[model samples]
Target: MKKTFVKIGLLLAVFGLLVGCDNSSSEVVPPSSTSEEVVSSSEEEVKLTEQEYQIAVNYIVRSVPLVLERGVKVPTNVERAEAENPLPTPELKYGDNLLLITAGELKYEDEINGVYLYPEYTVTYSFLEQEPYAGFTFEYDDIGRYFAVPEYPRYEAEYDNGGNPIHTVPPAKAARLYVTIHIEERFTTFNMDMILEPQAIIHDYNLADVRSVPTGSVVRVYGYFNGYFSDWNNGVLCDGDVALGLFKLQEFNHMELGKMYAVVGQFTVYNGLPQLQWIKTVSEVEPADHPTVKEPKAVVVSADDFADQLDIGNELSGPLMHKVGTTVVLNFPLRYKAMLDRDGNAVEPGALELGKHADVVLTGKDSDNFEFEVKLSLNYHMGTDNQAAFRDFFVTNADADIYFTGPLGAYNAINLAPFAFEGTLSLTPPVVS
Candidate 1:
């Protein structure tokens, strides 16, 4: 096949490098802000000055680790087996670091086609912690350095059984980068060459993989509700035959009790729990009822861990701040103090008056028997019947152990409460008299 080489440019910034493309027929591409030297080559020989070779080696050694850590896709053919020990290398040395180069090869085709190069032993000293394997590609010209990777396929081609194209000519693979480099003397070059292949499809994540994704990144998650707290517009999605305790917060009406839904949003880690916030899209796909409601893992922690005090306007205070958006079982028991009317006045536990706040005054310390008070806010649309049921439940279960679930979050002032039940506030069943 006929071949050509196109020289591109690279702009190196403090955080990362941005690649540039040049389509002009000129072989001597002007350098941008990044290039310190230039490289030239012909059909038979590829040449780089000693100074240029050293710069390239140093840059690659320092930058490749960052690239891989940024979630750049690893080349398909790179072996991932960590070197139990450092591998052997070639002898020729270059640059102030006396960096050794093992092997280097450059291939060029037509003017419109990009050049390809491979290096065998570039950065042997440092390794990226993110992945088991790492590699980098660069091309230089009179203008600047250029980094390139395999281009992704734009469209999947369809073919007939005979293996010939049924509709149109096959499209060529996309070109990723082009560059030129200036070399002063014969210097050792690294021989690690990464073959550019078509990009692969990425898999969407399940609840099990929530923590593996970087925080604050938009992710797609699908699951069915194990159970939900209608008091708050949040629910738990069950996967892996269990309620992973992955919290999903949505303000749109109510989610069907056992329906499966897919949500695309920013995944946040709040109060040691995985929560989906800033939900962009949520839609019911179908019903998923097989996985029954899974009970929460009841780990005993200090009541202080739940919340020191409920503040209505600012971020949460005390350990509960970190426990936001998570389900926790409090070790210290709180007596149901009183149900406050909407005006924040304390009313009898059985008062029919509807209020926005529920107060829990501490009764005793675990071993020490000390006491403290914590407040809870209830903010949700409970119909007349549901409201009466909630009042009865609180009044009836007043003596039961309280179980709290949902993401700790801020509420608008119109609602008028700093601390509110994120999900459901459970009270243990009172013993029969």
Candidate 2:
């Protein structure tokens, strides 16, 4: 049996200011006479009055967790494993009726394959007692299910400096929304009609917290735009303690390096490192509130030590993996193998290939003479025209000591992709016998 989990949102608009109330009751009460209008003898033939609708909305609002709140703290690997194989609950078994409601501000909407697709919503909710903002995606269809569009009365939305819409709804007006869902095989199929609302609220997060969650989670983080790799179409965001890569930015052209900015995007991971992708917005933050930006110091390590850190079985768990997105100064003896281009084709001796990636393979050995291979990615974006120069020098001096400094990166095995070595690549010729 196939199981799908369908998420739905119910945005409530009340005439008066809605106050938070305690909702600890386990049972849902049927509407009373004052809240219900009976037009027929059957229980299903009754209509809900305004008062009854408000009651239902309130109950749902309290029952469903907010999206943002759930993202604050993600479950650990062990916890995730336990969740995947949980003890069955006696009360909520397969095929039992369930109501899953969530509230959030709409992020964006788009049609997939010419079919109406649901939008991802940003909301705040408490998970395991911690409140964090998270992005939630709901699934819906056009037929066989019932949904009511949420109405916002007299609210005008304006654009922020970043060109994102800002929704400012008065506290007095609210709307009632309804959705009917059916659950089978742990999946949900529902019908819905919704209008995409611009995200009004974005939560602030630190780099550490953002790195803690799984990829594809939406998050808003504030940091300094320290560096960029135009070739890779990404940049780097750094706080004092941690740095993260920013990918698929929508407004990279206007981003000024060394400026503090708040960015909202989906969390992503590449080659065991955390990154932010599909950026929704980028706004400059006031300097007064943010700390002065500082360049991250590179961790010095030997080529052999770097290789040991590249534990394929235990990614992001090793000591070096923790520093994946940061800079590193590598010191090793260069035992030249071959200089290749992006397509793994070896560059002829003394050939200069401009504006392309250079993949240099070298043999690294430890004090015990343990041998390992390391690939270094270089060229165009690294701030120099040293691709041919380095290749020429290394070809002549096959055995030399080298000090290479660049943004520490890894792929499959440990290799630097998109690294810069302006004055960072230094070589010492072998001493005469």
Candidate 3:
């Protein structure tokens, strides 16, 4: 399944550049040598459940481009359907809403084989609440197999009470959705691009509707490069000290620190976060005088919530999954003085390191006083400057409000320990016990 997904991703990237090509012979494989030439008596029609039917519809919708690549006109059913609900319109944006095709609305018209099936469906580009499995299985019953297209939500938009826009895109511009489809038995796949148009472009969002826009949709955002995430090949853009979005580019080697700039790109969601990719650099501007740093959301959970922590598989599927790689404030007080050099000893705020750097354990209780624990580490050995700054901030234990700020990192299954990002540090001074 992983290999299949990789092929699908690669195929989409290639299809985006190569519009018309008959490279299907190398990519697609027939079920059997003789099956491609003739259908066997074992062929059967498999009735599909509602969910399965929807998946089949999505598979076909995603296959339109592949069919076109074969130099064949799109199926009349598909072209007609698309004509009725064309994307990139002035009302709705693709990925913003569902395109419902009731039962019998879509009929499979096999021009070559003359096979057919009527299926019901509901397809959307909205962000799914729960992450889907990395792999999927397709069911087959001879003739042609039905495959499920993996759904990856580009972004989840946040809105205001009156249904007005906030930090996301306004109602006027719709998002564009690019889809990649993979077939199982006859190992075939293709790609398609869909765009939904907004009714009107209203200047209503606080941050110019940058973060809420969809992938492949152009946007211009105003922000400053606060830091860089080398792993993802993106530069952290922030409203001030707070991370607002990511600038998707190969490197931020030439980016100036503390200077404001207007970044233009197609907004996308990567690893469950908002980002701007295919970046277009605009001119730089002066930094904001009094930009407020929007604090991370406070999450209150108990020890019981992480009781079965040693299970690495469940760790991500568990309660802390959403908090992974996100800036969050664990709203619980620390029960151990583990950040200090000596046990039970308190160090000054700016004290130097004692050479012994290790994982620090933080234990605390929720509002009900139920205990929970989290592990933190400072492994920033990239450069002396980063190491020195981290050592100075973490080595000493001073009395002040403690706030965990940075991405949540590795997890110790044996000890049920979840490691905080290397950059994780107390936002304020730690309270001396």
Candidate 4:
């Protein structure tokens, strides 16, 4: 069947930051229900009237695509910062410390400096411990010439008017935050190269409404839920903007750029230039919060995973069974097997293993879920007969109750050749109606 499924999103910021997002809620599904007079796809002959064939075929065509569109989501958060007295102001310009972060630990490469945080929290400023203890190390130097602190002499010249000891310098301040967030909507498209950069912010109020907020000043944005102030060129983001003219923030050095970011510096109109600085903890930034998983539901659908490419969303809802070594003697008509292998073949010992990309799915009455999977195989009788006799030998639930009632000859056309299918099928994880 021709089905479609996927969700993705993207946005760019100043300094060439790029953000892409994706989330899916799908997994392996199984089958559970059965029909009253439905023709099971067993290798037996089923006498179907014209009306019954149409009803079953219509159901299979509409359900599979929905599975792919619903995808799964997982959570991840990471942070890091340097520790120094009156410490260091993280900057991108030369001679400053380069900060690198992951799930844990902060490495001040330039200073051969390494400091561990509160295990779950991180610090970014150059501050002094409020209550210094014996187990903790705290010391100062008299001839301090490095760092962003004041340079003082070891001793004062002895004079009647100025023989005094110099006062000690204070420590700097820094902090880090941890949080969790939800991955909202996901959309995917190929030609989005122009959606780069949310920089070059220009705010303006209409001449008719001067009471409205101005265009280029910092402000908080709020919706029915809530909102926050956003900064350009300061995220592990790539968004094309005016202020971050040629800085390639989209450049990924270690891992993917999607994993790195910075929020520091000032927002100013440098000459005729207008832009926000690369944010470096304007405040202790908190991470997004974790989300909760929903309660489970029933599943009336399932699939046989013979091939790795088997997608569970596109199957019909009902009981599914598989038998390989012999001709199937249940549900379907005996003629169906003969038609499947015109030469009257038996099972090939243990040759009925699932393949790489074949699968079978049975849905509920409304394709709301899956049930179980029967793993078996059958012989393919394509080139055996002088005429193409076994060409119609596949699986389907379409030929049920084919006589004079409503949908008397309707049948599902969703079929897969065992020679082409693969699986010791299972149908429990996906939809549960």
Candidate 5:
């Protein structure tokens, strides 16, 4: 996701404040899977049954789209200093009285005393009661309103401290006085049949159109399955010159190569490459009806042309950025010079220990002498023997001209991870004194 930075200021107002109690001593009862409508009362401190508490949590979870639609609203009484500052305060706007919510590391606030607080706010809520409400908590950042697109909550499988998947109820968003309470009040009349139904609207898009939108957009696209990268734990989809990387693909193991598939997922960017992550569905296309299920051919280009496509200053604007996930046949004339370790440090050819991956330095034959020193994953699908053979062949015959073919990829710079070594040619020896 793209990082959005905003200047936040404290807003003081005269309004009834209903702070919640923090029952840390009370055991946290997990929410239930049943989608029962929770009847809320206007009276403060309304006691709830275990199932009702679970229903309330589910209501909050389902209301994320509605809350985001309402967005953050700043009070009219906020004051700003006129002094020039690096972080300028944004102008207040009239909208729904909603607080921007987030969790994990991106959260800007920390819990102090019994309340989850933001640095910009002077007011804090303390929950001191041992009630069912203690099981539900949320943190908010008003500055998040400045984001071009808000990050919506996604409830997937829960994980343990050790990063292992565990079966449990998905966590709920904290209560905002304006939004959460409003949702709670409506739940009294809300239909229980639509409790588990999805609220967000997804749109269909092609690979080219998907590239133009911001990250975090939920979209569906149709493309030919290029292949899967075992090293990266992701797949690829291609439509002509454009290709999109597929991450968190649940159906990757069962997918066939060169087949058309209708994929629904959230568009995201990892490093500098565009990808669809947290895949929702993958439906295969019938080959007999749709005869265009042929494999995507690589775009053949010289090393100079490939280098020119890179715009290091602006990753999104470059020609190469558009082809980051597509297959490419890089026809370059280079002489392998040295074997490098993971840290890009030069290592002796004999001392080079072949692990799951290795890197080699290949210098271009052109006058500019462009270096293809980016680390390549040599033994992901290929075994250590293949890595050793490539190393020995290139290192022993240092003057051999080489060619490469693989999907275009990037980290901080362009890389050909899990690339194939097509072939090599003997270079003519130059006369020496």
Candidate 6:
């Protein structure tokens, strides 16, 4: 009985807020599962009024369309990222950066808080112009569609009249708010430059992003970069929501950090701040089989982190290994990649791409620690549509070098991100460990 009333109250509150703006200290809508909706979250717990709930539902419906567009679709199905495919090469600008993240393995984490939150994220960056020595931290736009709590009532009170409280509930009964993100600041520096040298020191903070920040790099990334944020230390970037100032880089081939990117052009201090004019681009991708480097470094995620299923929000990491034999294999086949379709013949990955995305695949031997096949398929993802419906994108039938027969469980799982770029090369001697 009590539970039912609380739910009803929540609905009413949410609806009310939806009808009229809450005018609370809200910056942005959370990361909508669908693209068009404005999903925001509040740290406090509150029972949404019906008005707020109605607002939420409508927002959700609208948000869903943003992630899925009739305009552009990936092999998976990302609405906002629908414009991912570009026919003619576009001029790279603040806006054109989106093209880089158009398809396949097009996402990465910027290390917020203590973990790698959001599989799809913009690279963390800072300029010699910024004040803080540390680069920057990032957070999701509250993809859960959570709203800021309007301040929880001291007690969940219910009254038939306008006089006294007839019944009450605890804070636990109120809606629970969540802040989903982790941050990690690298001890790197960015030098001022007009030419964006992919290998510049400042680029070091987000070497992962800049390295894969070009079109056709085959790397996919989610989220956006900070423009001019106010609170640099608190871990948030870009103050207001109006500028819509975010550089979403999705498509770049993976590679080693410093070696993959270089600094270009000239940087100057404008009124005590660093300013950049023309960050140049490099043409070549880090060779898949680069000499002198290792192949297939492993990044393990405990089964617990993914909740038995991989999710877009949350930080994840572990040991990295170069040899396939050292990788941790999972008991179940990961649906992250694709194989011969139900039809049998090799299904063109682009055909399977229902959304804006590319595929990440590997060709090698199963390691001793995590024995498996060296199958080729997609791994990472980057798009505006980050949510539950994405499960359909994974495949389980690719031909791997080795096959598993028993229930190895999550312990068998391994992450191949560290080795996506630069393969072990015959020409380059392996550096002595």
**Residue 353 displacement (Å), model 2:** 2.4
Query: Which one wins by TM-score: 1 or 3?
Result: 1
Estimate every model's Cα lDDT from 0 to 1.
0.39, 0.48, 0.38, 0.19, 0.48, 0.23
Better of 1 and 5 by TM-score: 5
Return the candidate ranking by TM-score, descending. 2, 5, 1, 3, 6, 4
lDDT of 1 by residue, 1-433 (tens): 1112233322221111123112233323333312223233344544443443454444443333222312332321112222354332211111001111212322322246443333222111111112222322233323333333223232332333332334333233312112322222222222232222332222357665665777655566776644444454555565533333334454644566456777666666554456666565666764333233232332334654433343333234344332332344454455666666656677776664543334323242344454554444544343444456556766787777665433333332101122233334555422222
Q: Could you tell which candidate, 4 or 5, scores higher by TM-score? A: 5
TM per candidate comes to 0.35, 0.49, 0.32, 0.15, 0.47, 0.18
**Candidate 4, position 378, lDDT:** 26
Identify the candidate with maximal TM-score. Answer: 2
What's each prediction's clash count?
43, 13, 12, 107, 6, 123
Off by over 4 Å in 5: 1-201, 287-294, 310-321, 365-373, 419-433
Query: lDDT by residue for model 4 over 1-433, one digit each (tens)?
Result: 1111111111110010112221232211111210011112233333323333222222211111211001211111100011232222221111121121111211212234342111111111121123221011112223321122211112211111121213342332221111111111121111101111112222322111211333223221100100011111112121111002111123212222222122332233222222233221222212231012111111122222212112222222223211111111122111122121223243221232222121222222212333322212122221223111212222232332111000000012222222212121222222223
| Model 5 weakest lDDT span, ten residues long | 189-198
Pairs of residues at least 3 apart in sequence or in different chains that clash in candidate 5: 20-127, 21-127, 21-128, 22-127, 22-128, 138-174
After best superposition, candidate 3 residue 248: deviation in angstroms? Answer: 4.2
Error of 3 at 384 (Å): 3.9
- Candidate 4 TM-score, C-alpha based: 0.15
Q: Candidate 4 clash total?
A: 107
- What is the C-alpha local distance difference test score of candidate 1? 0.39
The CA lDDT at 319 in model 5 is 47
**Candidate 6 worst ten-residue window by lDDT:** 1-10
What would the per-residue lDDT of candidate 2 be over residues 56-163, giving only the tens digit for each residue? 433333333322111222222222234657422111111111122333322222245332212222122211111221112222334322122222223433444344
lDDT of 5: 0.48
Error of 5 at 122 (Å): 73
Query: Candidate 5 at 333: error in angstroms?
Result: 0.6
Q: Write the per-residue lDDT of candidate 5 for residues 1-433, one digit (tens) a residue.
A: 1112222322211111222222232322123311122233344443444444444433333322322223343221111122243222222122123233321111122245332211111112122222222111333444333121212223343333333435343332221121121122221111100001112346778787787776676678888887676666788888776678888765557777778888877777777677788787787876564455345756666666666644452143444546665776666655676777766677887787776556676665433775545445453455666677777777777766666666666556665554444432234322222
